[model samples]
Target: MGRETYTGDVAFEVRGHLGMITLNRPKALNALTQLMCESILIQLQDWAEDPTVAQVLIRGAGDRGLCSGGDISSVYRDMLEHQPRDGGGLLPESTPSYAAAMPAEEFFAVEYRMNLTIAEYPKPYIALMDGVVLGGGVGVSAHGSHRVVTERSRVGMPETTIGFSPDVGGTYLLPRSPGNTGLHLGLSGIHLTAADAIFTGLADTFVPSEALEELTQQLTEHPVDEVLPRYAKHPGDSAVEQDAEWIDAAYSAGTVEEILVELEQHSSSYPGAQQAAAALRAKSPTMLKVALEAIRRGAQLSLSGALAQEYTIAIHALRSHDFREGIRAQVIDKDRTPRWNPGQPETVDEDLVAHYFTPVPGKLLSLE
Candidate 1:
C-alpha cells in the first residue's frame, strides 16, 4: 500500500505495480560488485513471486551509464594477492573451507547466475540502457524482455581489450546477433549506437534520453506494453547494419587468423574493414581466439549451457597472465598497451585454447 525503498550500491523501490532497481555506483559507472549481484538476484527472486509486482525495471543512478561492467579492479586485486602456483599444485579456492572466502570466483558465479535470472525472468524486465553499457552491463540489460536504448547508448562487450574473453552470457547473446555482427563486435570490442544496438538485437526500442524520466512515470502507472508505444522512436540507421556485408564476410572466416585476412581483403571496398582488422590486431591474441571459440560454441548451446561453459573459461582466465596484464594496462596503469603473452593470434595454439574449457575442480556452476 505504501512506497517501499531499499538502498546501497544497488537500490530497490516499489511504485504502484512496478518494482524498480537502480545501480547506485555512478562514479564507477555502476560497475557491478559481488554484493550488488547477490542483492539483485535476491530482489529479482522476490519480485518474481510477488503477485503485487507486475513487472520490473532497472536503470543506473547517474547519467554516465547503466553499468560499465563487473568490478574487475577487485578481481584484479584478489588474483594478485592469491596468485596460483606455477605447476597448478595449489589447493582449490572452492574448497569448503575457503568457499565463501574466494571473492573473485564467487563474483563470477553470482554474476553469471544473476544473468541467467534475467534471461529467464518471468515478469517483463525492462532495462533503461542509457550511456555506456559494456561487458557485465550487456548481461543485465540485453537479457531483459524489454531493453530500451538511447542516442547516448554506447554498448559492447569489451572483455578482449582487457586481455579476457567475454563472460556474463556474452557468448550466448552476441553469437545470436544478426549475421556475424556479434562475432565482429565481440572480437573487436567496439561500442554500438542505439540504432546499432537494436540492429544487433541487443535492444528492443529506442527512446530519446530526455524522455526516459517521463517514460518511467508512464511505466509506474501502466504496463510496459502499453507505456512503451508513447516514447519509442526511430533511432535512425545503424552503421553496423550498413556495413554488415563486410562485417559478415570478414567475421565468418574459419579462425581469427583467417578472419583478419578477410578483413584486410575487404579493406579496399569498406573503410571500416581495415580498421576492424587493426582493432582485432590490437587486442590480446589469446583472448581473441578464446572469445571466437566461445562465441562459436555458444551458438549451439542454451543460455544456461553457454553460461556454464563460460564459468570454466572465466576460472581459467583468473590465473592467466593476460588477464592481469590487461587490467594493469587498461584500468590501473592507463598504459593502453598490453603486452599479451602470445603476442600473435597464430601463436595461440589450439591445445592451449582447449585448456580453458577444462572444468575447474570444485568450481562448477550449478545453474539450473
Candidate 2:
C-alpha cells in the first residue's frame, strides 16, 4: 500500500502503526484555525476506524509549544463584519448577530464538536504538550487518553483576559480540575506548570522536553501504552498544589463578589491571593460572573451538556461591549488596557448574567 499525501498548516503522516499529527504554524505559536481543527478531527476519525493504527501522536512544530489557542484575531474579525440573521429582529439593536457571525460562530461550533471527538476517541490519543497550550489548544490535548506534558509546558484557559470566557470545552474541563483550583484558574487566567497539569489531571505523564523525540520514535515502532511508561518521569513541584488551600478558600464562594471579598480578606497574609484578586479585577466583570456560573454548572453536567451551556454564553458574549473592546485592546491595539464596562464585579447584576444562558436564536450544536 502507498502512503497518503496531505498538506497545510496541519499535517498528518503514518509511521509504521502510529499516526502522527503536527500543528505546523510555529510563528503564531501554532494558533489553531478552522482548517487545523478539521484536519485533526478528520485524521483522528480516520485513525479510529483503521485497525492497523495502534495509536496516534500529536505535537506542535517549532520550540514554542503545542498551540496557543484558536486564532482570536480571526474570530474577532468575523464578529466585526457579522451580518444579521433570522429576519434580523431577534438580536438587540446594539448586539452583533451571533447567528450571522462568520468564522467565530462556526469556529466554536466546529471546535467544540472536535473537542467532544477527542474526549470520546476510541484509540489512544497521545498529546505532546511541550509549550504554551491554551484555549483551543487545551481542547485538543486535554481530552486525549494519554496526555503528556514537559517541563516547558504552560497551560490555561485565558478567555477572561481577552474579554471572553474560556471556550473550547473549558467550561467542561476547567470545572473538573482539582479542588476548586479550576475555578481559580478559569477566573484568573493563570498558566499552570507541567507538574501542576499532572496534579490537576490535565496530563497523564511527565517527560522531559528533550525526551519527546525518542518518545515519538518509540511510539512509531511500538504501542503507546508500552512505550510511554518507559520514558515517563515525575513532574516535580506544582505551584498550584502549594496554593490549593489558598485557592479553595478564595475562589469557592457562591458569587464572584463573595469570591473577591474572600480574596481581599486573605490579601495581607497571602499576597498571592491578593494578586489573583487584582488580576480578576482587570478582566470583564460581566464575563467573570458568566464564567463562574458556567464552571459551576459544568461541574454537574456531562461534556456535551457543559459545551451546550458554553455555546449559549459565547453567543451572548458577542453582544457585550467588553468582548469586542477586550480584543481590541489586548489583541488589535496591543495596549493591554481594556476599559471594562462594569468596572467592578459587583456592579454586574444577576439579571444580566441570566441572559447568557437564554436560548440562542440559531442552530443548536449537534454534539452527538
Candidate 3:
C-alpha cells in the first residue's frame, strides 16, 4: 500500500502491506543496543494492533549479518560505571549488589520483553537470518513464526565464552534442540551452519542469499504461503544430526567434568569430540557449569519460566569477575586469554552454581 520509513540504528519501513525492519549497523555487524531493543518492541506492539500491516519481515541492512549480539561493549561499560571503580573484587560476595538499578538491567528487561513479543506476535513474523545470528540475534529471529536461514547463516549462543550463560530465552530454545546438540553448542559457543540449525529446530525455511531480495519483493505482492514455496529449498543433511551419537553420549553426562571425561575418552573416529572438549576447557569453568545446569533445568521449564531464570543468572553474571575479564580479553584487549576465577571446571562448587538460580531481590523478570 503506502510506503513509510523510520530511521536510526534500527530502521523501519512499510512497503506494500509488509512491515519491514532493518538492523542498520553494518560496521558492528548490526549489534543491538538498548534503544534498538526498545524501538523494535514499540514497533511490534504498534504493528500487532494495526490492520493494514498483513505481516512483518526483519533483516539486516548489509551483507555482514543479521546481528552479532547485544551491544555487550556498552553493557561492559555500564557495568563499570555502576560498580566499584577500583576494579572490585572478583568473588560474587564482593560484587555490587545492584542496590540501585543500572542500564544493563533495563537493557535486558526490554530485550527479553521484545523476545517474548516476537514469540507471541499475531501476524506472520519472518526473520531473514542470513548471516551471523548469535545471542540477541537469535532471540530476535529464532522465535519468529517463519525463520529463514541461508547458506551464509551462522548461528550459535556463544555466552559461555564470555563467562556468561545463554540469555534471551536461549535456555528454552537450545535445550529443545535435537538430542544433546544444544548442550554442546551452549557450552562450546560453536557456530552452526544452515543445515545444522534446521536439524536442531532453530530455523525453518532455507532461502539462498542471492534470492532474498526477489523473495522479499514477492512477499510484498503476495501472501507468505504463496510466495515462500517458490524460494524455499532444502538445506540438505546436517553434520550435527550425524554426530548426534557422540554428542549426546558425551554431553549427557551428569556434570561438566564428566562430560569432558567422556569426550576425552571417545574414539578417534569422532574428531569433533576432542574439539568439543578443548572448546569447553577454554570457556569459564563456572559459567560452563552454570550454563549446563541452566540448559538441563530449562528442559523442564516453559519459555516464560526459562526467561525468568535466565534473567536471574544475567543479574548475577553482570557482577562477576569472569564476565568482565572475558570481555576484556575477547573484546577490549583482544588477548584471547581470560584467567577464570576458579580456573578449572572441577573446582566450581555445586553451591556456587545453585547460587545463580535464586531470584534477584528486586529485579525479577515478570513475564506475566
Candidate 4:
C-alpha cells in the first residue's frame, strides 16, 4: 500500500495493509496539540472504511512518551489573554473561540467523539503504549481494541494536577477501574507501570521494551485477529495483581479526605500508597473532590452517557476559579503554588461541588 504524511508532523503509513499513525513530536515528547488531535481524528475516519486497511496501529515517534497530553501551556496562554476572567468565583468563562468560531468547547466535543470512535472502531485498533501516557494520550490509547504496554509505560488520568477534572473520557474510564482503584488514580494523578496498566484493565498486553519492534513487525505481517493469540505467550501477571493489596486498601476509603488520612497512616507500611497520597495532597483539593465525583458518576454510565456527563463538568470547570489559577501556577507562571479556593478538601461543600455537574444547554456529545 502507499504511504503519506499528513502535515509532515505526523507520519502515516500503510504496511502490510495495516494503517499506522505515529505521533511525531518527539521533542515535546509527542505532546498533542489541537492540530494533532484533528489530524488523527480525520485520518481514523478516512481509514476506517478503507478496504485495504485491515487494522490500525497508533504509537509515538520516540521512546519518551506515547503522547504526553494536550497542549496545556498554549491553552493557559489563550485563556489569560482573550477571555474575561470571571470574578464571581463560581465558574470561569469559556475559552476563546478558534477562527472557525469554534471555541475550546468544540475542540473538546470533537476530541471526545474521536475517543469514542476509537473505542468502538469496527476494525481492530492497537495502541503501542510506552512512556508517559497522560490525559489526551489516555483518551486515544486506552480505548483501543488492543492496548499494548511496556515496562516503561507510565499511565495516568492526571487532570486534577492541572485544575481540570479528568476530560477525554477519563471520567468514564477511571470510575470503571476495579473497585475504587479508579477513584484513587483519578484524584491522585499517580503514574502506573505496564503491569499496573494491565491489572487495571487499561491495557491488553505487556511486552518488554526490547520486543516492541519485533512485535510491530509481527502485527504488520499477521492479520489483526491472529496477532493477540500469537503475542499472548509472554510472562508476568498484570500490573494490578502485583499491587492488589495496597490498591484495595488505599482506595477503599469513602472520601478523598478519608483516603488521605488512611494513606498517611499507612505510608510506613505501603510506601507506594503513601507517596500517592502525598501527591494528591499537593494538588488542588477542590479539583480532587470533583475528580472523585466524576469518576464515581462516570463508572455508572454507558460510554456515550459518560462523555455527555463529562462535557457538562468540563464546560463548568472552564469557568472555575481554580482552573485558571491552576493553569497560571502550573504552566504559565511556573510558580508551583496555586491559591486554590476551598484550599482544603474539607472546606469544599456538597452544593459548591454540585455546580460542576450541572448540564449545559444542547450540549449532547455525538458518539458516531
Error of 3 at 33 (Å): 0.4
Question: What's model 1's TM-score?
Answer: 0.95
User: Per-prediction count of colliding residue pairs?
Assistant: 0, 1, 1, 6
Best by lDDT: 1
Residues 272-301, model 4: lDDT tens digits: 777888788888888887788878888778
Of 2 and 4, the candidate ranking higher by lDDT:
2
**TM-score of each prediction:** 0.95, 0.94, 0.96, 0.90
Better of 3 and 4 by TM-score: 3
Query: What global local distance difference test value does model 2 have?
Result: 0.83
Candidate that would win on TM-score = 3
In model 4, where do residues sit more than 4 Å from their true spots?
82-89, 92-102, 228-243, 362-364
In model 2, where do residues sit more than 4 Å from their true spots? 1-4, 83-101
Q: Give the TM-score of candidate 2.
A: 0.94
Q: What are the C-alpha RMSDs, in order, of all predicted structures?
A: 2.8, 3.1, 1.7, 3.0
Looking at model 1, the pairs that clash are none
Better of 1 and 4 by lDDT: 1
Q: Per-residue lDDT tens digits of candidate 3, residues 1-368?
A: 54656798999888887899999999999999999999999999898998888999999988889999999998889777766534422335433555667789889988999999999999999999999999999999999999999999999999998888998999999889988999998999999999999989889999999999999988887888889989989998888999999999998899999999999988476999989989998999999999999999999998888899999988888777778878878887889998888889878777888888877678799876
Per lDDT, what order, best first? 1, 3, 2, 4
lDDT of 1: 0.90
lDDT of candidate 2 over 1-368, digit per residue (tens): 32454767988888888888889899999999988888788888888999888888889999999999988888777766764322211246344455455567667788888899988988889999998998888988998999999999998888999878877778888888888999988999989899988888888899999999999988888888899899999999998899889899888788898998999999998888998999898888988988998988888889998888788777777666778778888888999998887768867777777888886666467687
